[model samples]
Target: MTNLALLGARLLIGALLIGGAVQKALSPGDAGGMLVGLGLPFALVWPALIYDALAGLALWLGVAVRPVALSAAAYCALTSFFHLNVFQATGDAWQMTIFVKNWAIAGGCLALMVAGSGAWALRADRP
Candidate 1:
């Protein structure tokens, strides 16, 4: 397959997680507190960062696309479910927008899992 397709797919999904990872990594105190306030454990933040960072990097580099993308898809779905009670959230409602968006991203990740990484990738096939 053409590398452009892979590049587009990777960048589209990878950038989201990469940006999230960076944001969380940089200001985890606030994020962790927010998670705790949301009834989610604060202790999960660090491991999430690591997972997002690794999966983001893997997708960005087109390495182990299937496995990482599969995990990322699950992550996206769980995060969506985690935020399911946003109607009761004390935080801004805007944070709720990503519920559907994450599902869409998960769909894209599933597509990548089936398609594998295209050309110009570090490891184009599933690991």
Candidate 2:
């Protein structure tokens, strides 16, 4: 049951990341603009798309989960900052929701990192 739960968590997180990458890819202009608006280099979007897809895939396959989860957690926490200013008087409520959601996802990633992929994985990191 524990292993199943872990697998489910991995699948959910992985799918979310992959889907996010796809969404960003679909509107790279918007993504780049958002980054630029936040004073970040537009080029950052390219690497973000690649990293999200690869890291999500790794998580889905249960490969190097601890390291990947750690990175994903960090990624989520860091990216959440980009949405931090979405609570202004005229800011979109959805953006704020996404911001909080990122932190929640980060917490889940941290838990997965410590749990070490449970008992089911392509190559189990532990017995």
Please give each candidate's TM-score. 0.87, 0.93
In model 2, how large is the Cα lDDT of residue 96? 88
Off by over 4 Å in 1: none
State the local distance difference test value for candidate 2. 0.88
* Cα displacement (Å) at residue 41, model 1: 2.5
- Please list the residue runs of candidate 2 whose C-alpha ends up more than 4 Å from where it truly belongs after superposition: none
TM-score of model 2 relative to the true fold? 0.93
lDDT of 2 by residue, 1-127 (tens): 9899999999999999998799889988877877888778999999999999998999899999999999999999988877775445338888789889999999999999988787688866684
Candidate 2 residue pairs that clash: none
State candidate 1's TM-score. 0.87
lDDT of all predictions: 0.82, 0.88
Query: lDDT by residue for model 1 over 84-113, one digit each (tens)?
Result: 555356565765776778898899999988
What is the RMSD of candidate 1? 2.2
lDDT of 1: 0.82
